[model samples]
Target: MKEMEPWWKRSVVYQIYPRSFMDSNGDGVGDLQGIISKMDYLKKLGIGIIWLSPVYDSPNDDNGYDIRDYQTIMQEFGTMQDFEQLIEEAKQRDIRIVMDLVVNHTSDEHAWFVESRSSKDSNYRDYYIWRDGKGAQPPNNWGSIFSGPAWEKDELTDSYYLHLFSKKQPDLNWEHGPLRNNIFDMMTFWLEKGIGGFRMDVINFISKDEKLPDGEIHHEQGYGDGSTYFMNGPKIHTYLREMNEKVLSRYDVLTVGEMPGASTEDARIYTNPENQEVNMIFTFEHMNLDSGPNEKWDVRPLELVALKRNLEKWQHALHEVGWNSLYWNNHDQPRVVSRFGEDGAFREVSAKMLAICLHMLQGTPYIYQGEELGMTNVKFDSLSEYRDIETLNMYKEKRQQGIAHETIMSSIYAKGRDNARTPMQWTSNGGFTTGTPWIRMNTNTSFINAEQAIADPSSIFYTYQRLIQLRKIHAIITHGSFQLLLPDHPDLFVYKRQTAEEEWLIVNNFSEKTNQLVWKECNLPQTKGNIMIANYDSPKLEGDMVEVRPYESFVIAFERGK
Candidate 1:
């Protein structure tokens, strides 16, 4: 008999960037009470799981990612009681809440970090990675993801602490058994709070090479690529397995690790069922395809062929061994329509097309907040308009290097994280808050708001709802075998998902130019099956040929040997 699939495998997850989602207390910041008020909205969208970005007590250095307290809720968000109520309210609507677990690092202000930095002999000193630096330089040439050196000196102790991200966020020492246990205890506290699961933030980086060797310098920036020493590090599996056995195994919960530099081979071990680590992992390969040779801030056009190749590699690699977390937009990514599709002329159609292209695959689909409304990237004319640390750092670094401001702005337009953090356009103020917002809302909110999308049946929001409903009713989307079709086609992303009894042909025109689909190339019969879903008003299907309009997408279901 076949094994039963987990709930997460069949569920469609919606990611909510808490700070920008909604605000209830008129504080110009979104809060837990705001999320409680939007349960019905999420339910209407057919979202089964809500993967909320970090809402724990934080200094907002990385927008809640730099967690300070594991048990408390951020004051700007709400009280712990408000969070509990939010969970209960969501549970009533059958929407499981998945908390963002940021165990890899903590804000430097965290009690442990404060105590650790107080003295070299402090017991908590080992709780974080602290090393004596060479004369005046850092122990190594590693650079932080945000910019500058990854190590920060503690004047009191005359030592440096590792921080892969912002200096305010210091990396935890997973090598310390007590530190690992403390993390596990925190997980248990949340699991016991009745939360359904966790979406671990850069969890793979928790473990590191103990030697702390210098990385090879690669970029025009003088710092070395330290990802090799930290990301998917030597003891990552051992750490994850321990995490699984200690806290995760005791609960029936969804767990997906955010692995920045992970490959398909690493995914095999991280997500394989027998390994008892995580249910799935979010890989950055496809997301980084459009990134230029130097870094993400270096502007580059989207290459459909490269995107297809990377996606196919992941889909096929984990098809049998592990599960995949499918997503195009997340808290850390720019808006999908603006990045990969036409956000001006054919925004709705392109958004729907991109949705169909990803959702039909054999993996759990994740929809970022506001993506259903065909949200485009924010075009901030001035760098001061940006809020993300990474974006600000890149802007500063590029300017210091004497790179043209226009060039940096163009790259920010395409890949800035702030693009995804803009207030959810619900009304004139995007309905995100009654007062002034922390960050500016996208000016397109007048037309692209949720209120407008919900009223229009033909809008991208409804299209996403339909796609999600189809995933629930169709087994092929969840467990069928995936095959890439028209691999050589430059403008068309075509693929097939097959099972023993059913087959699905998913064709997407990725470009604005109309393309002719030679059905014969698919090796299917002349008889057309039912059109499961399509973005355009009407799709043309003739004998062994189909006319695909600009940014058009369709999924056709066929029976085997029919």
Candidate 2:
């Protein structure tokens, strides 16, 4: 008999970046009601999970990652009642709602932070990490992720507090027992309310070095690399295990951690099943394939061979023990079609190619909003139109250092998080809102909207829908072993998934140029096969050679040992 697996492993996830999904009240913000309104649309896509981005009460600092309150819904998003209604609506369609949990830090305006900063002797004094300044400068030369010092001094207590992201977002002190208990209680509150699970944001950074020692400084940037002391810290595993014992073990739910810089060694322990820290984690190794050492903003051309090796490594690393969360686009990433595929002439074609290439891999697939419609990145002429804190800060810093505006804008165009935050193109006028949109809509919406995709049978939306359907029908997609066919192939990504009964060959042409595969060159077996899916209409494998068009891909299943 075959062993049973969890629902999440076999299920596809659809991530809804709420601020840009839809607006029910014409308020230019996507609300819970907007999500409720679109329930049927998500249902039609055949996804089992809807990973909703943060909707908790916030000042919109870092776009809701800085939570002011955990339980209350953001006024812009609507009330807790609306959220509850959303849960019921989603449940009716058999779709579970997984919330985005941002517990590493809280808004400076939060009640706990307010009280904690009032005095060193307050009841909430130890709620956050606060330290004394070194004479006039900060406690250390740590850098904020948004391009400044990580420490922000509070005049009230005459001390400095650590903030890994923004100054307004203060890092919590997990060393305090009470704070940990409070977090667990908050988690239980949500679990009881029927949330399926959590997508923990920077969850690995919750713990920190108590000594708060100075770190290695970079002279060019004049900031210390303090991530060494915080990321995957000493107490992180203990804290997560405690969370599992207290809150998670009671509920049957899915949990995925957005862990930056997580190595496969760390993942083996995190998702080893015996440890039970989390169900899976999103690693950045593959995501950084197109970036250089400075940052993700330091854009570079991606070599297809490097990508194959990186993903193949992860596939084998976790094949036996851990699970991987497969995704090409997310709330914080540029659309994959634009970044990796030919978004100009072969937009939809390449979109389908990317979807099949990733969905065939061994992992739970995630489809970001507008990805199904093959949304392209925006090239806004000026920086004033940008709302992302990271983009704005980078532009300002680079300009001050005498960098050309065009050069900085080029980086932003290639890698800005806002690229994924564009309002969903429901229509030519952006049916996302009747009134003004929170951000500018992509001009391509005229032809690339959901209304168009859903109407056309050969659209990217149907490609994704079919991909999800195929996953449900084929156990080979979930449990089959993966093998890279041509690791040195420059333009082709050839791989196979095998089971006891069959093998599936997935060949993708990642470039715009057509490639000819002479069967004998790779020593691959020449077998009569069944085409499961393909981007092009007719992709026939003539004897001894397979000619794939630009961005063409297909999966052909054949009997094992044929």
Query: Relative to the true structure, how large is the alpha-carbon lDDT of every model?
Result: 0.90, 0.91
Stretches > 4 Å off in candidate 2: 1-3, 520-527
Worst 10 residues of 1 by lDDT: 519-528
lDDT of 2 by residue, 348-411 (tens): 8999999999999998999999999999899998788899998999888888889999899999
lDDT of 1 by residue, 369-481 (tens): 99999988999878888999998998899899999999888888888999999988886447888789999989988888888888899999999999999999988888899
lDDT of 2 at 84: 92
TM-score of 1: 0.98
Q: What is the lDDT, from 0 to 100, of the residue 429 in candidate 2?
A: 64
- Cα displacement (angstroms), candidate 1, residue 453, comes to 1.3
Model 1 per-residue lDDT at 529: 85
Query: In candidate 1, which residue pairs clash?
Result: 426-430
Q: Hey, what RMSD does candidate 1 come out at?
A: 1.1
**What TM-scores do the predictions have?**
0.98, 0.98
